[model samples]
Target: MITGAQLRDAYISASNLIGNEKQKVDELNIFPVPDGDTGTNMSMTIASAAREVSRFEDGGIGQCASIAASALLRGARGNSGVILSLLFRGFAKGLKDVTEAGGQQLADALAIGVEAAYGAVMKPTEGTILTVARVAAEEGKSAAVKGASAVEVWEAMCEGAHRALAATPELLPVLKKAGVVDAGGKGLTLILEGMLSVFQKGIVIPSENVEEQQPEVSVKRAVAEWEGEITFTYCTEFIVGRGDQKAEEDAKNLRAYLESIGDCVVVVDDDEIIKVHVHTDGPGNALQEGLKYGQLLTVKIENMREQKRRAEEEAAAAKPEKQRLERAEPENDVGFVAVSAGEGINGLFRDLGCDQIVSGGQTMNPSTEDILEAVQAVPAKTVYVLPNNKNIIMAAEQSVELADRKVVVVPTRTIPQGLSAMLSFDPDRPQEENLLDMVRAAEHVSTGQVTFAARDSEYDGHRIKEGEIIALNNGKLTFSEKTPVKAVTKLAKTMIKKDSSFVTIIYGEGITDEEAEEARSVIASKAGDNVEVTMVNGGQPIYYFILSVE
Candidate 1:
């Protein structure tokens, strides 16, 4: 039988092991795309659960598993992270109400976890983490049926996982072509091996290079000190769901009410929701006033003075830390949160009515927690989130469940699509109407990108050489050129249709203003003067220019 404490220790060991080997799994990425973050995503997802479990001094196996599953769901970052969370969610369900788990029970939990993972994915692909988990669970079930002990069952599961991971190359042609196994499978295998090591060898792997910590001040003392310096003690925030209420009027009234009681107030309203943030001594009065707007979501109250004191103490102890942004209640009806990189792009989104901009794109995908923080910061009833990248949509979607506000993801797969969606948004309309309009507008625009090929490869019959300028039309590699201007011109010609009227070119960091103008001139020469051409300094990395034709 495995105790809850033992299970927690095993999970910590697994997280540490995966962290140490994350780079190895990352390198196994077979996709030609430059961004490879499978290993990092999986590691962070499990690390979240490990941290949560460490806080529990005593609990049943079911209690501990549930805690881990909950944390994983909230912290899930990417596709791999979401899938891993689903697997653990099923495991927690299977272990529910059980204080201890035997070999047979553990095997059943693993099998359940695999089933949940497969069911959650729209199209379950083989030769990935799903296949590895399924095979390992089946092996564990077999070992349990043969009267194996808990440790023996776990050992068999690890062995099966390794075997499946090694065979992934044969199942996926892309993996074979890249001379690597599945990255997700490799990551899962490392986690299982680490867990097995704890049971079989009694070796607990410490987290990779973790520094020792110093703890001194108590929470009571911290709060007492905080009360002395700040006029307002409670930092309150909540989201109100719009239910047959006038968003604009209600938001204005709420802002007035909050301002009367507190400072640093922010009130944002939209067609479907209203978000409020304020620092006040009387949080109950604020909550009462918020109920008039709609049902409250994500009600949070913290002592700001306490947080400030903590930051000061950490700084005094020579520990460098980033300062937290001050929270203000929303004062608008509609709020927009956009994910973008580069100062120019951020400023553009801000100019286009975006309330908050999350700094992430391409190689660095923001986690679900990052998106959630951004969502909470926007004080509005209905908050629209533009992921602005295909890979980031899932992570952004996960924030909806965790947020207090009514978060509607606009599903913008590119920066151009995001900008077009913003342009189409009508603040006077309902959320449902705006959603359709924004999506339709984004769909009508054709996006193209020009970036240098990261590696030499043959893709779609095109011999792409490293450092060559490659033009991608609607995400497909269409052509390559020796120069960015030529590639942009060729890409623009291909993207421009008979009905296309406007061509917008957003130049990135590597290209100077002169180079951007030259590229725009080449595009205009090839595309004809009939099409209206515009240029903006995007200053983003990875791509030389992002083009949108509509």
Candidate 2:
């Protein structure tokens, strides 16, 4: 049987291992489109659980699994993250109400997780994480049937996952053509290995490579260990009212007392109050020591191990939080939440009646919680979410179950598609009827993009070199060009049909207005007098121009 402590350490190890090596998995993506990194998304999703579960001390397997599943679902960031959450959600169900799990129970849970993951995907594909997970679960079940130990069953699963990962190239032609295994599958395999290490050796994988910025302060602070036994359990803080006239002179001795009992010690001696922050196993003892100086005014104590990663997250979230727009209560019958980046593109969505705009797109995919928050903020009985990027669609879909009000996902795969859907939405029409119209409108519009190659690669028979201009038609690589202007103009002419009536050139940042107008003129001159050609500044990164054709 696997104890709660064992499982908790295993989960933390998996999160840390994946988090530290996300960049390596990111490089396996051959597609030039700058979508969210699969490894990064998966790591963040599991780490959300790690942050929560780390706070629990010897919680039952059932309770820990439940907490992990809930956190994973809310924190899911992309298609990969959503799938990861689904897998864990199923795992949690299998282990429900159990303090510890035997080999058979663990194997059954793995099988259950695999089933849920497959069910969640609309068009479940082979040669992906789903395949790897399925094969691993099968191996685990086989090991359990042979009466193996819990650790033995997990080791078998890891071996099976690695084997499945190796075979992914043969199952997915894209991975084969790129000479790389499936990125998502590779990420899953890594997590399994990470967990196996802990199950067998009782050692959490260290995240030493993970950088933690040490801010210079007058007080000394120590970070909790990422692996092995944590030096301190509680992070205690308090304020003591000074009771003596010699409190200022005694402050030096107070600081010394805190250092003796804790690793991270901060004691600020003031004329009136002495503020202290320390990490120690004995919180009551520390408080007692503080009382000798004066009376305790305010006290706070937390698990220090959980604070390490959370502190890094707080620092990372600072910029996005400041940039995030405030959401409002529902005021209309239907409200829209669209995911996009850049001021201009966000403005376009906001102008189109989007009640809230989530700051994400190809560069970043917002978590399910992010979308859910936006959906709840809308002051409407019925809310519609526009993912606006194909990679973000699954994450947006997960929000449907979490949102309080009626939430609908339009399934828009591009910024242009999102805009077309918004234009098609008729407030006067029935909400359900408008959804069909919006989908149809989005389907009718063609999306063309001109962006630089993220890396050197051979895709769809096109040999693309890094830094070279590339054009894509509805998300497929078309051709390469010498300049952004030439690429946009050529792409426009190709996408325009004889029945086409309008063309809009949305120029991104780094592209001059002269170049945009020049491309518009060329497109207009070729498109004939009947086709209306217009241009706007999108100010988006990665893509030089986003062309919308109808």
Candidate 3:
């Protein structure tokens, strides 16, 4: 049986392991685009649970799991994080009211989590975290039925996860071509391994690796005062979802109007919306100006002086509470937070047992402020943040010092690796063991992606034209073709060399099911007999297909 204390230790260990292996996870990103980040997302997802576990006085295993599940749900940022939270939620329900659970109970809990994860996703697919988790849980259940101990059953489960992960390439041609396992599947294995380590050994203090940081700003003070006195007390911002009006025209008009009223006027527009940032005395006038173009989706006005005064007062009053809180006896657990962008990807992480999600990606990077809000929202003593996108990693790390919760940032740079790292997590093991396991799994992946060129560009000695299909290996352009299927096959072949066993292709927006099947057939022919191939609907924007190898 595993006690609540053991479960707590396992969570802490998992977070640490994710943090250590984060870089390896980042490297597995399929795109060179600044947004490829999965390991970071998984790490952050689990951190929410870790932080929640840290908040309670020694509680039963069930209580800790419940708290972790709840915290993960609200703190979830991206697709992976949200899914991860769902998995834990099922686990919590399965372990309900129990101070501890035997191997049989744990197996049941794993099954429950798997079911919940599947339920959360709109369309479940093979060759991903869902596959790895379902297979592993079945193995665990079988082990338990054979009268294995909790440790023994979990070990079997990990082995099963490894096997399933290795098989992902066969199921998905992209994975086979990339010569890497499913990134999300690999992450799930790491989570299980981390938990196993806690059960087998004691908690180990994490080694310090000084992470670089942006210049720390006391944003928590809620205000900045200048000696020159406040010319404008409020910072106002609004986003208008584009209607029939052209963004450029709207931006031009908004800019001209803001220039007349505000000194610091910033207006930016994207395909979907226009964002206006300005320092103004009258926020109403700024908002009124926005109404000319379209519907306002979001609006914010911050009173600099009032915010500062309140922050200062709150900090002063909370000093004693903070001191007492700091002196409280330490617990053995930690939690994580992640950011993701899609439903399928979200479900993949949840099935692996992530604690939270921060919804964002490519076209939009969650501000440091958004990440900070998630960190504070998680009810844990210590939380880890994963900014899966390389661009967001710095922003995620920036939230650590600002957070009252002890925060660790694992820089996972891609969705695939982020999912792989979470699969590596385990709640039954010591911290060091789990951390090492997660890191190892993340390091073992190679990722590839297939997309179309936004414009013609001649670089890296490859002649490229607008509308050409392109394939990338860890961010570098490898091939360009006329057809999506041919481009996908070429990319897969480039990635799946000797020793390849599995391949997975996740098709995205605008791709029809018939087209995806055609692409699959081409992949199957090239995959050879030893390899398996499969396809899925990622339903994401931008890229047409994401491939993985193992």
The number of the candidate with the highest TM-score is 2
Q: Please list the residue runs of candidate 3 whose C-alpha ends up more than 4 Å from where it truly belongs after superposition.
A: 204-360, 363-550
Q: What is candidate 3's lDDT per residue for 267-292, written digit by digit as tens? A: 88987789888767889999998988
Tens-digit lDDT string for candidate 1 (1-550): 7767667767777788888888887767644456637888898888888767755546788888899888888777677887788788898998998898888888999899999889867789999999999999999999999999989999889989999999998998877876788989888888888777766775656556453111111123211222112458888888998888774678889999999999768887788888888879999999999998889877888877677567547645775554543444666677999999988899889999998888888877777877888888888867899999887887788788787767899999999999999999998898899999999999998999998876667666677667788889988989888888788888898899878899999999889899999988888877776899999999998888999999
lDDT pick, better of 1 and 2: 2
TM-score for predicted model 1 compared with the true structure:
0.76
- Better by TM-score, candidate 3 or 1: 1
Choose 2 or 3, whichever is better by lDDT. 2
| Best-to-worst TM-score order | 2, 1, 3
The CA lDDT at 437 in model 1 is 100
Off by over 4 Å in 1: 207-333, 455-458, 462-468
Query: Model 2, stretches more than 4 Å misplaced?
Result: 212-331
lDDT of 2 by residue, 154-180 (tens): 999999999999999999998899999
Could you tell me which 10 consecutive residues in candidate 1 have the lowest summed lDDT?
213-222
Q: What TM-score would each prediction reach against the true structure?
A: 0.76, 0.82, 0.44
- Given candidate 1, what's the lDDT at residue 549? 97
